[model samples]
Target: AREVGMPLKMARAVQVGGPAWHWANFAKVARNFEWEKKVGNSVVVREAVGVVGCITPWNFPLSQITLKIAPAMAAGCTVVLKPSEIAPVNAMILAEIIHDAGVPAGVFNLVNGTGPVVGEVLGTHPQVDMVSFTGSTGAGKRVSELASQSVKRVTLELGGKSASVILDDANFEAAVKGTVSACMLNSGQTCSAHTRMLVPASRYEEVRALAQAAVARFSIGPSLDEASKLGPLVSAAQRDRVLNFIRIGIAEGADVIAGGPDTPATGKGYFVQPTVLGIKASDTLAQEEIFGPVLVVIPYRDEEDAVTIANNTIYGLGGAVWSASDEHAVKVARRIRTGQIDINGGPFNGSAPFGGYKQSGNGRENGIYGFEEFLEFKAMQFKPSAG
Candidate 1:
């Protein structure tokens, strides 16, 4: 909690819950070897992708590291990790734990340094067979460029501006509350947070009221404070960036329905108000990732218009759709272009596949899908002697 100013509960998601979930997945599940089969005179086998290079971001210091390393280990692939310098301590502690657990010295190596020093080398190194990265879209693009020099296999999980679509049939109160809580999680620093809310134009005024009321329930303070539901952002730069986005949103015609770019009353920590914006689909606030406790609510004409507005972005990471019927909710969710979406405030399933699509990112994490990212197909052939 103290490491990144994350609330204790949110911090636990990385410090404890993440490792536990990945380990449980391994210990409880049965491996599927059905893909190893014969065709003609050859048999196909799944082999490790060899040395994997993992470049993780600071927002999820430990969880992202585990997400990459655990599956790499399960697939019999060695790893070289470059954890974000902004949040480096937990990774070092994890390395020590691995060493004490008697993992071979070279099997898992930790090199703590800046992105240029460690991340770039890992991307272009001849010996590194694959590179897995999580960060901004710009950084991910740089990683891909460097990895291309070595023909390195790459997986990226980057930024998001996901939408929460509230259909007319959905229980308005429940959906609005759920969306607000989800957006403010980790103070909206999460890569896949549902930062955008889409509502029917007919009910726009009604939703704005609901959204304001929902967000009013959040109490911002120090991570350790018992009264605090939302914590300060990671750093000064992060705080400024978020506030700037808020300002830009307003300049570009977004209305500040709840909180604006104003400084918080705390007068100390790097804090920005937990804000909500009323905006159009084309507004920069609705399209780009603000990456803080900011939500942009947009109004759409109809169901089809809602889906179109939801997908009208450079990102396709995560989103949510609410409706009276599960089938109807899913039908809308299917139309949105994203990696994952929730149906009527469905709980996050840690074991399910998670990642992004489009500029948001490429590849998957979590469950067997993530495990496959570290594997490669190889066919062993033998010529038959006169049978």
Candidate 2:
């Protein structure tokens, strides 16, 4: 409760005048399952029908688990949670919290294991009615295929290769700094991080210098430190994956304009310095999802070219646009194929729908959008006075 409250307060402080920025708001709405029926005229019509399979990732462990569990409980559905083994400790803590919260036995269960073993089992299990997965596009595909045999409803929030387009008219310093920070947040593990930066060729050198300096100034260290702007990759395997992408960026001829390789002399945990790569529009790094502290900076001739380069990737989960004029930025943002686009460093609203396009996956989460995922719609008509 305290941690949730803190996030709410922080969001309110940052967003100001936004939606009811309180944890109580979430709890309150979560308690009201009838609201869905009232609005959509849809109901489960069957109580404790079957089990819900929740396969969550390591990032944002508690929140993701809660996102699945809370609604399932409200709908009177039992759940079998398979949280990522890399972050299983938090799952244990969450299971304790749910148990202490007085949720009934057999209503919520936790299974700790890898994706291939536990996740596949849960997805393919005949008794499970639905599966909610949050992971990579590759994993999401497999989960969907497995669930299809049972004809179970599936919801997925998968990988993203987001782009941040800096228009020629935008403030070069602010745009570069914001894009760099977005790329470095969560050590760039966030599915919606703006990893591909599109800049006008006229301001390419100027933006590159600013972004390079910004990446150099990021503080990478342990998660417990409040001052640490970045944390180590979740595990050694993730660290290696990120490092391999960095190597690929170099091999593909993307200029290492900023931080690269591992942090020097940091022996305790897995750490990679924030890296920035300047590549041509056609480079492989410019079109791939490097889910690390690696930014691919591509130069474009104009707004049209910038939009083209930004939308050239297979993933279209999220993006950003920066320009001197809000109207111009909005116009450019509309051209991108991403599900969500931020203009001028605007805040992210949890109440809005969040998902992706293309290989980034389908469907949405959060607000009324997320609530409808578990629902089945049926329309009925009655002929009056026919008798």
The candidate maximizing TM-score is 1
lDDT, candidate 2, 1-387, per-residue tens: 122111232223422222223233345655664532322333323233358899998756665776666656655678999998876876787689779978788988999999999999988999999999999999999999999999988888889889999998888888999999887766787789999989888877788789878987776655555556666776777778888888877888878888777564545567788899889888877776777788989989877888888888889999899999899999999989989998998878777888998888887876656655655554433344443
TM-score of each: 0.96, 0.88
In model 1, which runs have C-alpha deviations exceeding 4 angstroms?
27-35, 383-387
Ten contiguous residues minimizing lDDT sum, candidate 1: 26-35
lDDT of predicted model 2:
0.77
Output the lDDT of residue 43, model 1.
93
- lDDT tens digits, residues 122-182, model 1? 9989999999999999999999999998899999999998999999999999999999988
Count clashes in each candidate, considering only residues at least 3 apart in sequence or on different chains.
Answer: 0, 0
Residue ranges of candidate 2 with Cα displaced over 4 Å: 1-26, 30-50, 385-387
The stretch of ten residues in a row with the least summed lDDT in candidate 2 is: 1-10
